[model samples]
Target chain A: MHIPDGFLNIPVSAGAAALSIGAVSLAVKKVQKTIEDRLVPLMGVLAAFIFAAQMFNFPVAGGTSGHLLGGMLAVVVVGPWAAMIVLTCVLIVQCLLFQDGGLLALGANVLNMAVIGVLCGWVAKKATNFLSRTAAIFIGSWISVVAAAAAAAAEMAISDTAPFATVLVAMVSVHAIIGTGEGVITILVVSFLKRVKPEIVEDGACRAL
Target chain B: MKNRKFIVFSLLACAAVVVFAAVFASSYPDGLEQVASKMGFENKMSGINLMGAPMPDYGLALFGAGPFSTLVAGLSGLAAVFLATTASGWAIKRLRRSGNG
Candidate 1:
């Protein structure tokens, strides 16, 4: 979810922004080393897809809506480092052009979705190594969404934006359902790619990492 | 060039989704927005944004508040992000090449 301006206090926002800058810089370096030249267009297309998919909000409970976060999907298609770059670009564009996310809050939003979400997916996949790739993708994508929501809720709670328990429960509960949607979509897309172009799914560079 | 077709197909798929989303996305408040409203912190949101976006809320005022305007906005956004990311990837590749050289 995109956090708007004035949601978190200025200090928290700035702190997150600082951390985000460091993380993104590191990601750029890692991507440079690990991303295959041939995958560049694929990464770009995936970023665009993530941006477009974010526009469609499927209904959840109580008139609320949710959309695809695509952090883990990026990680699955590309490596974690490239996925970070893709997500960072998407978040920045959403903030600057669409005004979907607040500029000041861009740091927190990127940290939540790009860094934490992708990392959670990476960890989930690793933890579920014994399972099928499709299952791993599904679980990883689901965890990515829910974890990002949890991070956002924690930020809000720390900023005194809302009660910690209430925000955590509300954000997690709604996002858990949304994450299932993410899981299914990720599985389908990965499966399709696996069927159509298995070579692109090899991810040799990422595998080495 | 082995993956050229796959790349083209993926980009086209992304474009199609963008158009589809512009035409058919729900108009309800998202999870965070809904939660913020229920928790009584929705008023914390103000018109005070750091940057004045040309297309606020992903709609072009010039075209009025309709699906066409949203479509225009989504397409533009999709194109902008695609170009930005592609350029970033190119830059990174160049940097890597130079480092190797």
Candidate 2:
């Protein structure tokens, strides 16, 4: 979910902004140092796909809808550093072009969806390394959305915009459903990639599928 | 899908979604908005009208709220995102290379 402006207090916003900036700079460095030349277009593809995918929000449950967050998918394809940059690009484009999100809250969105979401989801996927490629990516994508929502709820609570317990439960529970949508789309896209470009998909075979 | 074919196929997929979003994207509130509305914090939004943005909410002011408007707007966004990502990646790579030399 794209957090609007005024959802975060000045301190929380500023702190998140600082962290996002620092992390993005580090991402640039890490990506540049280790990024394969072939991966550049792939990054562009991911960023564009995310930006477009976010536009198509599908209904989830109880009058709520969700879209693919794409962070986990990015990580699965391009690794965290490049995925971070890719996500930051999509978030910024949404902010400045689509106004789907707010400028003041850009930092929090990046921090939540790009940094925390990707990294934590990466951990979860790595933890489930024993699983098939399909399963791991789906689980990871699901976790990314939940983790991002949790971070957003935490920021709102810290800003006193919403009650901690109620908002946290609401955000987490609803996002847990939304996470399923994220997982499904990530699987669909990754599976498509695996079929078309086997080299790019790393483990093109899924043990279960 | 690598290089030209990859970029081309990706853009086509993005364009297809752009049309899908313009035509039939869900209008329901997302989880955050649903929660905020339920919890009485929905009005906490600053409602900043970004006058500078070319497309707001993925619709063009010129074409108004119809599907065609959304179509043009979504296409514009797709092009913008693709260009921006590629340009930024190239620029960052150049910057990193310059630091080494």
What lDDT does each candidate get? 0.86, 0.85
Q: Tens digits of per-residue lDDT for model 2 on A94-151?
A: 8898787788899999999999999988888888868877788888888999999999
TM-score of each: 0.95, 0.95
- Encode model 1's per-residue lDDT on A10-95: one tens digit a residue: 88898889988999889888887765667678778889989989988888777878899998788877888899999999999999
The alpha-carbon RMSD over the true interface for every model, in angstroms, is: 1.8, 1.6
lDDT by residue (B1-34, candidate 2, tens digit) is 4557977987898899889998898989989999
Backbone clash pairs in model 2 (N, Cα, C under 3 Å; residues 3+ apart or in different chains), count: 0
Best by DockQ: 2
**Considering summed lDDT, which 10 consecutive residues are worst modelled in model 1 chain B?**
B1-10
- Show model 1 residue runs off by greater than 4 Å: A203-209
| lDDT (Cα, tens digit) per residue for candidate 1, span B4-56 | 77767777888788778888888889888988988899898865756888898
Q: Model 2 chain B — which ten-residue stretch has the worst lDDT?
A: B49-58
Q: For candidate 1, give the docking quality class from DockQ.
A: medium
